[model samples]
Target: MLGRFRRKQGANTQTGVQEQDIGVSNSVEQQGEKPALHVHMPGFNHNGHKVTRGIKPDGESGRGGIHPWHFIRICFRSTSHISMIVNVLWPFVPAAIVIHFARPDLHLWNFILNYIAMVPTANLVGFAGQELARKLPKVFGILLETFLGGIVEIVLFMVLLHNDVNNNLVPVIRAAILGSILANLLLCLGFCFFAGGLLREEQEFDEVISEVGHGLLLMAGFGLLIPTAFYASLRGSIDDALLESKTLNISRITSVILLVAFFIYVYFQMRTHHGLYDSVLEKDEERDRDRHEDLKKAKLTLTECVFALALALTCVSLHAVFLVEEIDYIVTKRGVPDAFMGLILVPLVEKAAEHLTAVDEAWDNQMNFALAHILGATIQTALFNSSLVVIVGWGLDKAMDLNFEVFNIVILIMSIIVVGNFLRDQKSNYLEGSLCILIYVLIAIASWYYPNPAAGTSNTAEGAGTKAGG
Candidate 1:
């Protein structure tokens, strides 16, 4: 519904002007544009009268128009209520500090405080990323935004790797990777559609976004499948020792391949095929203009953006360390299922800010932006963050691989298919969103009962490494 006709009042009219306006309107129509109507988008309605005034054929002023949000400011602030709440959670950071040293036995409390504290820092990182993104050209900005958005997830993964003294966290890390993807695909996107549907009966976005996201996800899923299948097939033919070695080698190769595919995707997205995304970007611009935040310029300066990002990265890294350290205690001592802890709890905390942003974008009728954010982040979790963990594991010699449990991979592939089908028409409603969430709930329930395998016997590289080392 974006760019629909909505006539504005106060335009000059005079004798003989009608004929001139008619000619201009016809010319505008021939140019494939509506004759200078006030911008109208889906989910909102306004009574408009036909106007005789001349509107630029470009349909806008220079680079659209700049609203107050585009004004250069010295400070950075997020107007989102979620961001405010995340900001309020900042006190938990210091609380985590005190509890870690003062009362070290309270592992559960330490975990809660640290993860809660992480919310604020991750929000800050996203804000800084967004602010900095607005400073660059549209293409690079989108790429940068996606990269920085996943920084928290990446950092947490590395922290888990660094702290996995017994290989216990490796399974959880693998689960978290799949969990993050599910979170974005089902949870975040579900809320986006549900929220957007609350405003508009049905909303539509560019199919290209869906195609790209789904294609890449399928590719990543295939990468996951190959390694799992290899492990399964060879686990029978070969002895346990040889099978383990082959699995790790295959997983490492898959990681490199996925990374290569991701890089090629970046080029395809930002270079030769950049034109494919202009529709999304244009719609995003129209959405901002509708909200009177026509930010063709940035709200923060280079110095403020850099400083904010630095502080955010440090805080997120620090709190992530705190959170990872307590996982063992909760899983082993507290009897919380590691599968549930990884697949359900971890993603909720890690992607809190992103979920909020998606919902916000949907509420504002920016379905394109919302969908792009969701799909882009999910793709990042698959190709970038997940691969980094394997390669990082390779360097550390700590036995990490793409050998996710067969059950988990099946769930992942099915979820991807479900999401891809929903996106087939490039239209969304609350009902579709609800279904996605329902499936996620089912997955969570299943995970709640999922067994926490013994440290060395879990379905990961640890078993193989242990066998060989022994």
Candidate 2:
């Protein structure tokens, strides 16, 4: 709302003009060999105002009109918060419209894979921004990076969606998930330390922000666990039989009761630790304040940011739909379920795009935010996105359960193992990243074969339930 108008005061107008005038004055003073005395310039009346001639655009006494730098400075100086909002939100309009149209065509697999691709594009934009930052003044460089990075992400998502995707998307999903995690944990964090070492030892991390990240990670893990346990149960005939009998009965009400209980437990736990939570909130506020100050110093308004964000989201939605269709096509040819395709193939393909942002962010001194992005994305996909799939499925004609079958259990276990390792260390090297990639590859390979006799079960019903929980 504040970004809707231009500034009328023109308080910052003199700055750009002053810079030009000073530079010109210095250059002229240095041109002649003699020490020099000041001289006056000729004046003329123009447009109801007196015009000084021979001053050039440098804002000198006898200079010409406004210089290019001065003009740019004025634009920056004059724009108000209202104009900023327009700048930022305007780009998002196209993005939102695209997403709105494309949502029907997208499958879960496609969305995840496309998200992976977006990461890389974002990183690349970040890197380009870093380069620009080095070349330009800090304010312009950072703004350029933010603006371009946002645009790049949206563009990539749109491109990915423009195609039809189907089949074997599981690999892509899995690969992308790993890519996001590895880039954030290993690439972003590692590079931050490496590059940060080049500067001063006084550098500190945003602990409050880091705590939020930790919370996100924990939530993602728990969300995945639901699907994991459900899938594991399906492989166990005894457990599957019991659950099936109980779950199939509308009058039984056991599932609902359990869910309610679980909700209560979670609520109470949160209530108990609310103070600790408030500490995290306080820290977040501090970080936000600091960020705000930095942004203002850099002469960037939030509206430009909003515009870029909206555009990116739109492209991402479109690309996500395309990716889903392509995966479905590929999977049908390969004769695999859409879920498996999402779990495997889609992620692998999407990795190239996802890392772009991470790479770019690493180039900047913005590792903390980059880390947040990776972890936050993962959490959103695992929890919020997955949850929405289930809720929406319920609203649809069919009761779509997202139960994991036996194969999904393996994936879950593997995910748990890797995530645990990742969190335990909190510091990742290139080797760790490679290991994650290797783990994903192994899982992909293993998913292609038939299950053992002990593991064999009807894949659909249980798979649906587990997938939903996941």
Candidate 3:
């Protein structure tokens, strides 16, 4: 009996020990699980030792489950995205103001608002062009981007120049044409170089391509120079009507020549010497291979791209109508010279999208792509768009000429020279970029104070001439 009792006591002790081990295991598993719940539920304290009110043993946090601090952090992280949204939507504010006020006399307000509206629409064009280009060969893609990107400026000029038969805006259009070239060559290029240089000590691009682009730019400048020189020589000698007729003839001839040249350029870039522009293609292909899934996700169907392009162009065209209607009034009311409007404001509004793209490419150390974008835009504006404007003007019976003022001609020549020298080396740094930007700023300041000789005189003369001719 004594032995039996001893065994039984031992068994009882072993059973108690087993139960205690199981309890410890259960406690450890619970502890491990609590931290995961705390992570997803912000109401739970970090240590998992405390939970906020109304958060039961289940994993649900208190109402809404998002901490106030967490929401703030998210907003801070997405600040850039928010800025883009604001850029696209802010124009609506001015549009709303215009609707509320409904005052035609508020020309400056109207111009400012309409110009702001152009910016986001221009961005839409850029985005659509990018989408379309993705589905094309690299050389063709660049071409599409260049030509399509420039459509905004061309369309704006067409609408503005065509609206008034007397062509009072001839001087402004000339100034704007030269200004667009300068903005791309100096302002846009300068910013790109600056950004690229800041990101890296040095950046390199294709010298041959740069040289070719410079050659084309020089050609475009010469094309404009001939007409301006002809106008200057004839201005004092001939009567106003005869001089205008001679200028129109010269503009038409020059436009034809420029159109031909632009075609040749396109052929050269796209067919005869496509290899020059295809360096980026090989790298892009390799990248696409590595991130095939990513490329797939980003790709848009052809139909989608076309739809986007059409939609963007429609919006831009509508905005151009409003802008052209108010532009002259704005110039009159604000005492801002038409030359100044063309040189600074118009280009800024029209090319804002391309300007951003060049800077972005530069920041990524893709100097080739950056330089291509700048030069491509410069070429398109100078050769194709300028030529098209003249042709369109003639077709519309407005007879726009390429006769820029002496001040504008001088500025254009100087800008081309400065940029040519900078690009000759085929390499860039931050200092060079800073110098370009400084030069542009100085030019902008000079233009601001520069009086418009035609602004006061031409309006009266054009009115009288129209009456006499009629």
Report, for every candidate in turn, its global Cα lDDT versus the true structure: 0.76, 0.40, 0.71
Put down candidate 1 lDDT per residue, 1-470, tens digits, no spaces.
Answer: 33332222213344348779889899999999988866633231121222112321221222223333442232234636566556767778788878888988888898988878888778877877776675465666767877888988999899989987656577788889999999999999999889888878998888778888899999999988888888766665667667777888998998898889889988988888887686677766686524554332224445566777888889889888878888877776777776787788888888877787778878888788787789889888899888899999999997788888777888999999999999999999999999999999999999998876543353544342211122
**TM-scores of the candidates in the order shown:** 0.81, 0.46, 0.75
| lDDT top scorer | 1
Q: Give the lDDT of residue 336 in candidate 2.
A: 51
- Write one digit per residue (lDDT tens) for candidate 2, span 1-470: 34433343343466768788778778877996444567654343222223334321112212223355533342233222322222232334344335545673444434444445444333333433333333342323333444443344233223332331221222233323333343334443444444433433323444543555556555554544454365445555566656644333321232233344334533432455445544543343354423443333322112333333354445544554544555544544445543344444444333332344443333344544444445544443444334433343334423323343445544554564555555454443444445555665665566555331121244333323222122
True lDDT of residue 74, candidate 3: 27
The root-mean-square deviation over C-alpha atoms between each candidate and the true structure, in angstroms, is 9.4, 17.0, 16.3
| Candidate 1 collision pairs | none
| Residues 135-232 of candidate 3: C-alpha lDDT, one tens digit per residue | 46678887888778898999888886777657567666777898899899888889888988886788777775689889999899999898778877
Best by TM-score: 1
TM-score of 1: 0.81
**Clashes in candidate 1: how many?**
0
What lDDT does candidate 2 reach at residue 167? 13
Evaluated against the true structure, the overall lDDT of model 3 is 0.71
